[model samples]
Target: MTNLLRWTTPDLALTFVLDDGPVRLIAVREASQPRGGEPDPSQPLVEVAAVGHGHSSNRHAGTVLGRQLRYARHDETETTLRIVQEELTTGLRVTSVFEARAGVRAWTEASIIGPGSLELTNLSSLVIGLASIDAELYSAANSWMAENRWSKRVLRDVLADIVRDPHHHVANSRHAVTGTNSWSTGETLPVGVLVDRSTPYALGWQIEHNGPWHYEFGENRRGGYLLLSGPTDHEHQWSVEITAGKPFTTVPVSLVVGTDVDSVFAALTRQRRAIRTRRPIDDRMPVVFNDFMNTLRGDPTTEKLLPLIDAAAEVGADYFCVDAGWYAEGDWWNTVGAWEPSTTRFPNGLAEVINRIHQHRMVPGIWLEPEVIGVRSPIADELPDDAFLTRHGKRVAENGRYLLDLRSPAARKHLDTTVDRLVDEFGIGFFKFDNNTMTGPGTDKGGTSLGHGLLEHNRALLSWLDAIQERHPDLLIENCASGAMRMDYAMLSRLHLQSTSDQEHPLLYAPISAAAPAAVLPEQAGNWAYPITGTTREEFTFALVNGIPGRLYLSGHLNRMTPAELDLVRSALTAHRAVLDDLHTLVPAWPLGLPMWTDDWIALALNGVDVSYLTLWHRAPGPSTITLPIPRSKIAPHFPTDLGDWTYAWNDDALVINANTPEPAARVLRLE
Candidate 1:
């Protein structure tokens, strides 16, 4: 068979013939880059190594990572990549061209950004931002929310499943097939629009479930020599494997979008939003309140906990969910019906402490590990035989806890009764769900097929969610599966927030804070408020206040604080409340991580009305004047528009905002 490719523009462009097994590419720089293709009828661009799978038990599986490329300078108004592939139906050449919007430049040792290096970029003009890596390609919908009344469990389970299997369906994620463009006048569905531009230049990496439905045919596996876009500051991370017998060379391909890729994506995020999808969030503070008695008693005074909680409240935290380890070791480990206050930590009893929190004018919340019971505890002995999840007639043991397989109706009923008890007993506003991973998938009850045990487990958890939400309508749940393991939109609808990444260093949360806006809800984004060491609280506060619209909880004990510093945190939090209370509309929180410094971090908030941006810097740069250009269109021309006899101000084209502050201040500017 003739090579599928023909040289077009020498190596600058290639034309591919669509028939069968192998395709060819013609290169532009044959001399500078010596690829295997020689001076023939068509000099080859680069010969990509191939493999022939001798059999079909699904063996030879791999992926392509994004490539780091530097192009020769050209005097062109636009940068583009053209993709050409064939349509399976008609064997016609499908072509598409993608225009560049944002990209980056950085210094490299050997010109290849070494293993897992940073300095990433994407074309700056994104029409919409998504939350998390929940691409439709990877997620599948078993029930339509409108028809099934959309249970929180199903949504969360699907998302959790998707997160667990992140890359398995990249090429065929359901979301990938969703509409990505506007209508052709009065066209019916969005599928008709892809007639022409569905070319091979389609991104090589797929984050969706494309090949098989079930995980059995290697369906749920993810990882490859892949390419990732919208990762690491807008850059694509390409991974290509080099092996023996197939000496690695170069290959020519293009990244083609149908010019309207951004517009189509924006429409999907806005008009075509699926309710069961993950949320695009506003950032919030992560308050790590302790649940263990010994941990809180370490502070010696429950009242000392008051100051920290008070600090969080002053910063406008919506609800503070106390974390694990609160009950007495004997009481917490085994008791479900006998959940009494830890006498040592709360000598005054639980009600009094909760009342004190009420006086502080903040919501009180707590954590629970209901699915497990200490082996020594009486409850474990009391539970029915089916209440526990066991494999091969034995329970999975870790650190001396008997795991309750949530699959059982009795197990869920027990948890449901406890959720009711917590809210009824303590007036708890938030519940932070934490676990390592999961026990076994579940039983063979619901038409259980082998290797799909989690099917029943996930279904059981969703069943429990239905019961819990019925008792608690506005119950705010936080998904904390060791930091973002359970982050999925299915849970987002029921859960108020999420704690991303078990890692809590302020710098570590930057990406979570950055990417969350595109997917999770504003309040759900876990903006961890870590103890600042060298950085000014003002800078830290600035970053926190502007970056996230979440809660304010502290970690690592800054028990003693200077009056000035406390006030700075208080002031920053106060600013957060004013915005939260008024949240006219969340335009979008944009990211700015330039000057590439992690020693100091920052997150920005934008108010299109004020036509200004609120900047939060984590560390004070040694005194220097930094001039940032904010858009002039964001400002209002009129000093104050007269409404009858009253005067009011609005930002318009004429306004500009700027600020100069002493080390620790959260400053607001009306573009001067």
Candidate 2:
């Protein structure tokens, strides 16, 4: 009889069978499927391949395939399975750990117990084999402005062709998606979903590494396999020597099985919340007014900011932030270290501005790019070379800024002093932590590989953030990497808010704000609303509607606007706050499907328990109307009720609406 280990949640179940030789995944199904089906014995539970000094052990050659030395299980609401396997010849011990919550998270640790060292050429964090060859792969292709562009293709389309004459076995074809360097989501998001075309089963997984990582799918002899991993030698020049009594742990990866795409996303959402770090200020979800877009444009002075702060508070903004250029004089981008208050920008001291912001009853915030030291700053020479990231005995500079190595004590001390002084002296409550530049591959400071150095620095950066938050528990941090370039869950899971985009054009930014919920939570998404002076009423409404569905990051020169324009801004903020409670529990759904790069009409609906909120935009010059996915019950304008009139009707199974206005128009509606 096959000894099987089982773990189940309310909607998902996973089973592993140990058949005396190796442990293999027997079943992974949703609630609709029956339990205890026949187990597939072709593939093992964990696949680990390594090579050392001309000796190589491929994934299929791991000791787990020979015989399991011992096994144990731990139960505490969630289930954890620990299996230990030993290679008798090499004296290598491999421990596989599987944690089951709403989904399954697995990883492996390879330890050298003998006198010889081992070099790992290839290592996978997790691998799961499925019984389906007819599957379609789905992944998001992301970039700076065009983020989360998902595409799908069949497995056979990219598979290698082979003759199936029943005479010889065909080699498996591998298809991989990889991201290099420190920007985790610089190229593609660390997410993928595989759906069985012929059945209702789908498998999804995400690599939770902040540095370089890769995931691939390949055909095996039985069916197919999915492999997820972190950095490797060929890609990021990563490798580590395992000495005696030392063990190496790979990156963590999460896996979930569901009946369809929606179910897969639901499982992922639960898993994301399960792993997120707890914070106190997450429940507030305040509206922020930033003086960046179309206002000061990073050139804030005493004269330009005091009026804006008063105007922001008058319009019901909870937090008022003064963006970049507050700490420097003229041409200050390359001379930005030290973070001292500019003597020229503020005649008295920055304290006057902070006091004025507090008098207006708004939280005072400032912009900080903490990871880089300016090349022309005097502080650059004061710090030792080890304080910055080095390549080959020289500091690595990008765009006239040197990257700070958080692993160094001197670097951490400098940042802690700067942040603590700002909070204590200025009474600051919010910080916009911006990373404007990217250090290419990695650093080589401590006789380590560039990839390994970058991995350490990334982890160290998170640790520094934890320290800062612990010190100032009331402070909120906005994660901005030139506006969502490094916008991955690794940062979002810890940071308080995510700046969705920096696109200047209001009409072009509509689709970006509409599609942001797929990558970030609604309450954490910070979408900008920058309505300039010369835009039409429709265009002004278009810009203001972009920020209503998410956290309304208010911008533009409200102090210089007309009374009518100011009323529109206030109306939008009022409507946003009215529905803020529902947004906490709402899940995003694309009613008209996900927006295209240049869709004429774009829509995003946040489905809640009692009511749903929808934001619609019309960008084309011709007449157009969108039919939503849900049945029309009652539709009312939730924001800027004074806009030009529109028309709507309840179709059979969808809600149809016509903007009836000219180009570049939008509306925010409440559906009940």
Candidate 3:
């Protein structure tokens, strides 16, 4: 047997077998890879002689379903793998899986979920040979899909800033350098910003020990597929549905960096290990509140005097939200760069209002689209030539504001400065990052664009988020790309919550588009109640309690409330706090409708107190049937979770119920 080159991370490991009969690989380590040592030439990476066999003629692994991956596989064999050893040198780290089946590609298998899935997959087909790989040559761009949007000049403009300055500050800020507008350049230079030999690299990127940065690692999805890929076309995708009074759910990123591969694998071995399956830091029901945006910018006022949020909160709301114009006296849509107090109305500054709300015994929350900048702002003018992210020598635009480029160290630095001032100094508790832009811009090549660099920018942004999280371990970040387009596993890993959309009118979300967070992400228990125009204020209060299976959220302007509405809102919050104490886990059950287009969304079954509750939604609404998978914990002896029908519903997903409307609904189907 030839000596295998074994490599590992905290959790997985692989070894390459050199043979004529097909390149073979084995999973030798399911535990953390060697922490700090040379690759032990003594052991096999895994305990398999399985050959890497695949359909000779297959397309690349599609970004999602219909698309193809870099590699393809035939049903080889199923062998379990466990981590045997892992080592990390100052410049290198290695991991080995001892018992893994032969040649089951790391990301190619279904074992990985959520952010881990994206991280593990290098391309559609190829899993790297070790824990880490560096690239002397690399491409930092979106994919082919992006080439059309941003030209080369815009990308060049961006690279100039990223290289010269790499941080964004609240004080040292620029409106043109945030969010999806993280534009970059093409007239390339050697990217040599390494300390010692250790540097950060996403999985699947090929690396050589020595060389200038000039390697190409193919097809890396920042998270998983694109949410809003080509203009929302004719997929006519249905909004996710749940049982009438039933609820539907989806995932968000939740991970705990374990101490070793064994510990990490051990976390995975748990039955609840899925994409969005980690434990929630909080387990309280969200309270109902309202924001008053009566077409403040000439959109349309939510009817009803004073609105329902205050009334909802006074009675029982846990969250109170203030929308866009609250801080803007005029058409401040152009005032995003300077996140300051609106001296005209909010005279005492936001703190006074927050203090009052806290005194009212309510959790104070504020909203911000942190990665966006308006055309007219001090940031654009003050920022030097080497600041904002640009593509083809121009700023990227969304809604009307230019998306900020987070890749710039200066951009990150500026972001930290502003955020620290606003959050740390201002004492704000929550953040809602809204993206009103389209998912534009991809990668770049030479002095032009090949459309794949967008992912690079996003990955860099994620890196920043990771750094930011390290700063304010408990700070809450909300993901809002129009609604669902940007809500992928990558950003989810760090965000504590999300605001479903900017269109706070509950009515707008009625037939629920997949864009609605409540339809997909259960963790983001958010609801947009028009100031007035809701079920009785009590019903509004009820809505708040009902939205989040484990927390509370509301969107209404507080200052616009009447005394009566205030009392009503306060009372509802009290009621929700009581039901929140009983949640331990969340499980997905059958959704309300049949799967639609590309979405197979369903319900989230949560363990509250002693019983489990299902919040459901389906892509297509109908009298259709569904068979859900029950966990081993809920199974009868040894039956697979997808067995038995217990009708309208079908095993652990066994409870049968009538079809509810095709919109998002919450059902209290109790489980033992």
CA lDDT of 321 in candidate 1? 52
* Candidate 3 local lDDT, residue 647: 22
Pairs clashing within candidate 2: none
- The local distance difference test score of each candidate is 0.37, 0.78, 0.36
Which of 1 and 2 is the better model by lDDT?
A: 2
Candidate 1 residue runs with Cα over 4 Å from true position: 1-303, 306-320, 330-339, 440-451, 530-559, 581-584, 587-630, 633-672
Select the stronger candidate by TM-score from 1 and 2.
2
Q: Which ten residues in a row have the lowest lDDT in candidate 1?
A: 179-188
**Who is ahead in TM-score, 2 or 3?**
2
Where's the lowest-lDDT run of ten residues in candidate 2? 53-62
List ranges where model 2 is wrong by over 4 Å: 20-22, 37-43, 53-79, 100-102, 164-166, 169-171, 243-245, 642-645
Better of 1 and 3 by lDDT: 1
lDDT tens readout by residue for model 2, 367-455: 99999999999989988998899999899999999999999999999999999999999989999988888888899788877877887
Error of 3 at 71 (Å): 15
